[model samples]
Structure formats: C-alpha cells, structure tokens
Target chain A: MGETFKANVIDHFNFWVAVVLMMIGLYAMITKNNLIKKLIGMSIFQTAIILFYVSAGVKDGATIPILEHHAAETEQVEAGEHVEGHPVANHEAHAINPDDYSNPLPHVLMLTAIVVGVATLGVALAVTQVIYKNYGTLEEDEILAKIKAAENDG
Target chain B: MIWQFDIIILIFLVITAVISLRVKDLLAASMVFGTYSFLICLLWAGMGAVDVAFTEATVGAGISAVILIATVYNTRRDSSD
Candidate 1:
C-alpha cells in the first residue's frame, strides 16, 4: 500500500500539488475576513487551475508546438520550388508526426482563462474599493454589521 | 521537465500560498500572493508553455500585484480575523 501511494505521488505530482494549492485558496476564500485576502485567494485558485490545465497538456520528450523547418526546406520554399499549390508543402508538413509536439489546445484555452481571471480580479478589486468607500472598513463582518445597523435604523 | 526543479517550485508554491493566506498584514499577503503567481509561471514555463508563462508573469505577477497593492494601500491594512 505504501509503495503504491509512493508510485502514485511520483507519477501524478503536478496534479497533487495543484489540488493542494486549490484547497488552500478555497480555505482562504472561505475563512478570511479581509476582502482583499479573499481576492488573493480567488487569484490563487485560478492560477492553480491554469497550472493543472497546462500540466495536463505536457508531453514527455516532446518539443513546443511550433514546427521547425530545415534551412534547405526554407530556401526551397523561398525559391518557389515547392510552390506547387497545396499538395507538396501540405504533404511535407503532414510528414511530421503530431506526437512530436506538445498538445497546444489546453495552453490556448488557459490563455483565455488567465485573461478572464485578471479581468475578474480587477473588477473585484474595484468593487472592493467601492465597498471600502461606503463602509469605511474592509472587514466583511464590519460591513455586514454596518449594513444591518442601517437596515434597523431604516 | 526536470523532476527536481518541478518539486522544488511546487513546494515553494504551496508555502507561498499558505503564507499569503496566513499573513496578517494585507500588503505582505499581496506580495506573497504575487510570489505564488510567479512560481506558477515558472512551473508553466518548465512544462513548455512559454506563452502561458509570459501571460502569467505580466498579468498575474505584474498587473495583479500592482492592483492588489494599490487596493491594500487605499483600504485598511490589518485583518481582524
């Protein structure tokens, strides 16, 4: 049992770390009273997820997704020798195996996610600023108490 | 991906995450959180996602940290809980 656990830990180390980080972020978001701390937690959670996706796309012994061309091939292309419409170059491109490159889909998806996360963080911080302006405190409980007091007075 | 490098970074990542949450000072927490983001960016770069790492460094570490520090400066810096 111990050996199996060790093997699993070794094989899926990245996934395990991502899960741990995610839990830490969730804990902060749930337990913290400070609004900015919660925002930081949210950012941590988002980054953990991005890490998970990017790691999932990793290929063993594979290069990045960009295709490399030999100088001879480039010179041939530039000389218009391989300009026989779509067939020749396409055939040459197809000759390269897909498995030689890491999967780019997850990376592309996470790029959008990272942008969205940043935008969300910015918006949340702005809202936090507004909250502070109105209540004069950044603590959640204080804001809640003030709101309740206002409600009781009204 | 070198396992040794990955393990070291992952360990630091978790440590930073915990410290950022546990720190009482808001500015310190924001700085630790920025460190956490930068560590994750390093992890992504090690995994061969250069573009993702670049974006994380700029947006997550740079802009997010700046915004967070600005917010912390504008508001109360101490946490009650």
Candidate 2:
C-alpha cells in the first residue's frame, strides 16, 4: 500500500506542482490590487498551463522527436532477420515508430501560446500605464472611483 | 523519478509566488515575478521540454519582465487599493 502511494507520488508529482502554481496564480489574480501584480499573476497562470502541457508530453527514456539517419539503418538490420538474410530489402518500407521520442505537437502549440502570452502582457501593461496616466493610480477601485467622480461632474 | 529536484523547485515557486504577491513594493514584486518565471523555465527544461523552456525563458523571463518594469516606470510606485 505504501509502495503504491510512493509510486503515485513519483509519477504525478509534476502535475501536482503545476496545480499548485495554477492555484497561486489564480489567487493572486483574484485578490491582488496592483495592476502589475495582476499581470504577473496572469503570466504565472499561463506558465503553469504551459508547464502542465510540457510535462504531459514527457516520456520515460524518450529522446527528442528528430529522427537520426542511423535509426532507419538499425531498424532495417533488425527487420531483415525474418526475411531469410534479405538485409536491405525493406529499407524504405518500415515507418519510424512513434514511441521512441516525445510528442512535438504540444511543444509547437505552446510555442504559439508563449508568444501570445508575451503580447498580451505587453498590451495589458500598456493599458495599465494608460489608466495610471489618466487617473494617477493603478488600483482597480481607485480607477473606478475616478470614473465615478468624472461621471458625477459631467 | 527525480522527484526530489522537482519538489525543491516547486517549493521555491511557492515561496516566490507568496512573496511576490504579498510584498508592498511594486518594483520588488515585479522582480520576484521574474524570478518565478525563471524557475518555471528551469522546471520545464528539466522535464525535457526544451522548446517550451526556451519560449518561457524568452517570453516570460525576458520580454515580459522588461515590459512589466517599463509599465511600473510609468506608474506610481505604491498600490493604494
């Protein structure tokens, strides 16, 4: 029983860390008052999701997705045994197995996500600067208060 | 499982997160946030996601931090909400 618990911990530890990061980011986004801190929280939240994806793509003992030239040669040698010494016959026949390397799809998608995140952070911070320029404050409530005062005056 | 290293990184992440959020100074918080992003990059790289780590490091740690510090530069140093 104890062994199974330990195994579960080992296997899913990365997931737990991602979850914790997500929660921390969420908490900050909800509770923090400063605009920059909220942006930081949003960035943290994004990174946690990226971490979850990258960790999910990990496989034990898996190499990078790029295929080596020798892989086909080695595979042909292993497959040639059953063909009665016909060593080079199926050189171009067998396809590379998918299990030998980590998945690249998630990595590709996260590349886009990270770019979007940076862009969004930049835009959001620019907006924060604008808010401060107009209202002389970055706090959400203070901005609301200024808006209300302008409304009342106008 | 290399669980020890992962746990240690996670601990640092949590510590930085709490400190970054709770700190009073916006500049200090932004710096701590950059540290958090960097730690996340390390965690991703250690998990064999080199591409993701690269993106995180460049965007999260580098570009995002610069943009944030610039925003802080244009705004008040203290939050009053």
TM-score of each: 0.89, 0.86
User: What tens digits encode model 1's per-residue C-alpha lDDT throughout A1-154?
Assistant: 9899878997689999999989988998999988988988888898889889888998888877886777347656644645655445455554567687889999999999999999999999999999999999999898999999999999
TM-score of 2: 0.86
Q: Candidate 1 chain A: minimum summed lDDT over ten consecutive residues — where?
A: A85-94
**Position A32, candidate 2: lDDT:** 81
Classified by CAPRI criteria, candidate 2 counts as medium
iRMSD, model 2, in Å: 1.9
lDDT of 1 by residue, B1-81 (tens): 888899999999999998989889998988998898899889888888889989999998999999999998888788875
- The segments of candidate 2 whose C-alpha lies over 4 angstroms from its true place after superposition are A72-97
Model 1, residue A3: displacement in angstroms? 5.2
Any runs in candidate 1 off by more than 4 Å, and if so which? Answer: A1-3, A71-94
- Best candidate, DockQ: 1
Model 1 residue A150 lDDT score: 100
